[model samples]
Target: SQQGEEDPQALSIQEGENATMNCSYKTSINNLQWYRQNSGRGLVHLILIRSNEREKHSGRLRVTLDTSKKSSSLLITASRAADTASYFCATRGPPGYSTLTFGKGTMLLVSP
Candidate 1:
């Protein structure tokens, strides 16, 4: 089974600070992707790291994956109130499977 679970169900921080979240999964995966969702909106793709990759970055987002440990982490640098949202980690199984298993997500609240 493919499953991903995120840690620290919730996080609170002030604007300009940093927020970090972790995810762990069961079974092998081809790639791991991170997404962000506003309170009443669809999820937005953030970044993705392949199994062969150890790290990846996009703008203010940084992601690290450790296949050996079956884990991944997301780091948001220079947080903002507008950045407050739910962050989720999703995993895609081998090539033939187009489905993605998403984690419960971590709610991040940023105050100005």
Candidate 2:
């Protein structure tokens, strides 16, 4: 079954501003990963912080996890037009199979 779901189906932002998106999961998981999809390109791995980790940051990306709430948030600091894309969150099971289940992403548009 599908596990993760990102909030805000679509977002429009001005260049140089910030963008924030939230994700919610349904089941107990080993880890949650975030990826960025551009137009017709493959998803680019953004970040993968495990269940034990509460928060992580990578350059302009900041991720926060709240296991109690089964939710996570991604914050993009100083956004740009090039950042316009779809962001998805995936949940990885704890068992032997490491397949990732993805959610319907949030389509972000950054105006130049």
Candidate 3:
């Protein structure tokens, strides 16, 4: 499967703390996207950094791509209670079945 596996299946942090998640894949990919989904809701696109890029950031989120290692990491700074959600990494694979494959995700719980 052209899917990435994320680490720390679950996480809990205080509102003022930061949270970090990691994702690792087995195959080559064209791009990787980060998404956040609230409980029982669809995922919301957070960031997309192409294979050629090394790092990308949006607001309180920072993403890093290391194609050589076939891994990516997401960091959320100064997290708020509202920022609590599941984080997933989807990979855009090459050749057939290029559709994005999602990781199991890391459930983030931000305590107020």
Candidate 4:
């Protein structure tokens, strides 16, 4: 079952602006990952934060996880028009398993 759901189904912003998206899950997870997808392309892994980690960063992306709240948020700084895409959050089950449940995704539009 898919455990994660992202809020703000769609968002629009101008270039150089920042974009933020939040995800909430229903069950415990070993780790949470964020991915990005262009119009019709495959998803690109952005970043992953372990269960014990509170935050992680990569490039212009920043992610924060709160196990107690079963939620996470992804923030993109100084966004660009090229950054327009659909972002999804995925949750992985415990160690012995390799299953991943993905959210419907949040569509972001970064206009120039």
Q: TM-score for model 3?
A: 0.94
Per-prediction TM-score to the true structure, in the order listed: 0.96, 0.96, 0.94, 0.97
Report the C-alpha displacement of residue 2, candidate 2, in angstroms.
2.1
Off by over 4 Å in 4: none
Provide the clash count, candidate 2: 0
Q: Relative to the unseen true structure, what is the C-alpha lDDT of residue 83 in candidate 4, on a scale of 0 to 100?
A: 96
What's the CA error at residue 86 for candidate 3, in Å?
Answer: 0.7
lDDT of 2 by residue, 24-105 (tens): 9988889999999999999999999899999999999999999999999999999999999999999997867689999999
Best by lDDT: 4
Point out the worst 10-residue segment of candidate 4 by lDDT: 1-10
Number of the candidate with higher lDDT, 3 or 4: 4
RMSD of each: 1.1, 0.9, 1.4, 0.7
Q: Write the per-residue lDDT of candidate 3 for residues 1-112, one digit (tens) a residue.
A: 5389999999999999999999999888899999999998999999998989999989999999999999999999999999989999999986565699999999999999
Write down the lDDT of every candidate, Cα atoms only: 0.95, 0.94, 0.94, 0.96
List the candidates ranked by lDDT, beginning with the highest. Answer: 4, 1, 3, 2
The residue-level lDDT of candidate 3 at 105 comes to: 95
TM-score ranking of the models: 4, 1, 2, 3
The worst-scoring run of ten residues by lDDT in candidate 2 lies at 90-99
